[model samples]
Target: MDIEIIAIGGYEEAGRNMTAVRCGRDIVIFDMGLRLDQTTLNEDADIVGMQVADLVKIKAIPDDSVLKANDGTVKAIVCSHGHIDHIGAIPMLAQRYNAPIIATPYTTELIRQQMAGDTKAGDAAKLMALKAGQRYTLSQNLILEFVRTQHSIIDAVTPVLHTPEGAIVYALDFKLDRTPVIGEPPDVARLRQIGKEGVLALIVECTNVGKKGRCPSERIARDLVRDTITTYEDDKNAIIVSTFSSHVSRIKTIAECAHEIGRKPVLLGRSMEKYATIAEQMKLVSFPETTSAFGNRRTIDRTLRRIMKGGKDQFLPIVTGHQGEPGSVLTRIATGDTPYQLMQGDKVIFSANIIPTPLNFGQRHLIEARMQLVGARVFEDLHVSGHAYREDHYEFIQFLQPEHVIPAHGGMTMTAEYILFAGEMGYTPHATAHLMKNGQRVKIR
Candidate 1:
């Protein structure tokens, strides 16, 4: 029995994450995603119309040569979760090899949503809903177990691969959130059992290795929302907020906070509204009543006009564009495209950070400038990360106790930074922790 890992794309950078786990003739690919780089993707360029041809040219997707030997040998394509950076490349890659995609309910739906317009290949995927802790065998050589974990999104999973050589765990995108907004915490007992039984390797997310402290629970973000609402309770101003669409927990917190402050919460983004439907379908979070919806610029304008004319003073509007996407609802509104104008002191909150990219910071500055020009009070970074920090990564290493740990989901700098964390934690056997790039494969036996 043998194990092979193809650290495609994102293993060395911040996007286009695809990893292949092979046991003899049977192979499974986890996460066929895209990398978002404007210099690479071209600023002002949209991805919706972009096909695999364009993606390969920009090197935004993984080099398919890594899967050459195992092309048609794929038994299953297990989706670890539904973040675009992890699942975005699937519509183009899933059909090359015939395999049923296995994912949690919400993730499966979200993937379907992502592949909406790609009729040429979207129908080829056979998506099977995987419940947490359920084990499913794909072939004689490969078996998969879905272990639940907490992330910013709902129904995220860790794929435990059972091979003849040993068990390989893919803790793809997970945080130890005991008190999560949508699902139960990670299955620590199962992970420990696998470690005791002997794990060949563990691939963990290394997004925030150098950062300190455990991630605040999704509940803490909720509490922050509650506190922010209370802090501004006396002000009779319209409140507009923006955050990650997949952050159902944060949205739930904001909803509860809005309810407490006696305001109707109206979600106002296309992605947010689309994901809210799936979140409710998965029972992760439910939308509050009296919430208005508008995704398009024209509709948002009409909705705001109605809200203003109706004299709805205490209103909480949540839109997209915190990362400064120019076309997003918030930017359009702040730029005065909306028929209703905000005067004096309308409150606008950004529930996410700027992610520290120069382009992102530049865009954020422009958005802030627009908001200030309109006399809107802007508040930013009222949030926390969804990934585990330095101490938490060490704690996970202690718990899993795997023979090898390959840090993933970040660039060469982040990868090197994680190497320091491992050294401090006595994670010797650095040879076992393979540093790889797209098309690179590591053999384990």
Candidate 2:
């Protein structure tokens, strides 16, 4: 039986990361993600109720029509992490596949929540929770293994497919974080063992390949947030922070710092409440006792009013909209649409980087300008990237030492750069190091 690698999505751009590894008659798919940069929608846009065809037309979700054309059965739909770019399309697309959706425990909960919100898809797809360092048999020829890895979010893993030929590793959205704030470091010994055992094909992300060094640890982000927030510990002005709601470690850090500085950490916005609350509920993370969360516009606005009435110095509002997404808490507050007023010298801290899209940059710029006009002091880049960088990729490639390489989870330029980098390591393009685009397929003997 021959093996084939299919680039269903994410080969064209940074988001919507879906890939299929076909082994004879059975196929294992990794990530049915959504593209976050839909021009028609804002960063916080909701496509939950949207049809699969409409979302595909707008490039908001992966066009899995190509999968329908294949003859093989989809044995499993595996998600690497809980990020929207990894599992956002599940609610709309997973229903089409008559297979179990396998993910780490936290990611499984996230997917369950997403499916619960979309009744049309929820009842059709089965959900399976597979923890890291565990294995599940998909078929006689395919055994799936979850290898622990670090990223911006908790419970992220690098999935490996064990087949008769060799092992196929899916290393999208991972980082070699030796000192993560929340979990143990990447399973280095297990990865090295897998490398020694023999890897047939390695599909990896090239999102941060252009960056020169290894990605910084989440510990550094904690330091940056702590140093920044504690500097104004004595200040009486409002301190509003915005970050990726899914980043549980960063939220914990921000909340701890707020508690340390005698301020209650009030999580606002729907997503802010969802991700953090779920993480807390699972015992995956614990925030300060002073931390509170509010979702929905009415409750959020009411909470903001309470903050305003209770005095700004007493609370730190950790909100959404670091990308200045329309309708997010930070955006609403910045535009004076919320009851929480921003006074002169009030702080707005961004614990995330702009996700390198025209829409994100423009929205971020507009909201920053608006906040500055109100005399709010803005702090930026109090965060670290979750994707591995150039050296980290090099290290990963060295560890796996796979016979074939497929550069994925990036557009033309980023993927091409990985190919070039692989060339220096003696990987011939198309022969060993393959650069693929969305909807393309390559066969490996």
Q: Give the winner by lDDT.
A: 2
**Which runs of model 2 end up more than 4 angstroms from their true locations?**
39-43, 68-70
TM-score of each: 0.94, 0.98
Ten contiguous residues with the weakest lDDT in model 2? 39-48
| Residue 192 lDDT, candidate 2, scale 0-100 | 89
Q: Tens digit of lDDT per residue, candidate 1, span 245-347?
A: 7777788777767777777877777777777767876676776776555665567667777778765566777777788877777777777766657667888
Error of 2 at 3 (Å): 0.3
Poorest lDDT segment (10 consecutive residues) of candidate 1:
38-47
Models, CA RMSD each: 2.2, 1.2
Checking candidate 1 for backbone clashes, the offending pairs are 16-34, 16-35
TM-score of 2: 0.98
lDDT string, candidate 2, 37-152, tens digits: 76445435667667788888888788888876455999999999999989999998887888999999999999988888777776634899999999999999999999999998
What is the total number of backbone clashes in candidate 1? 2
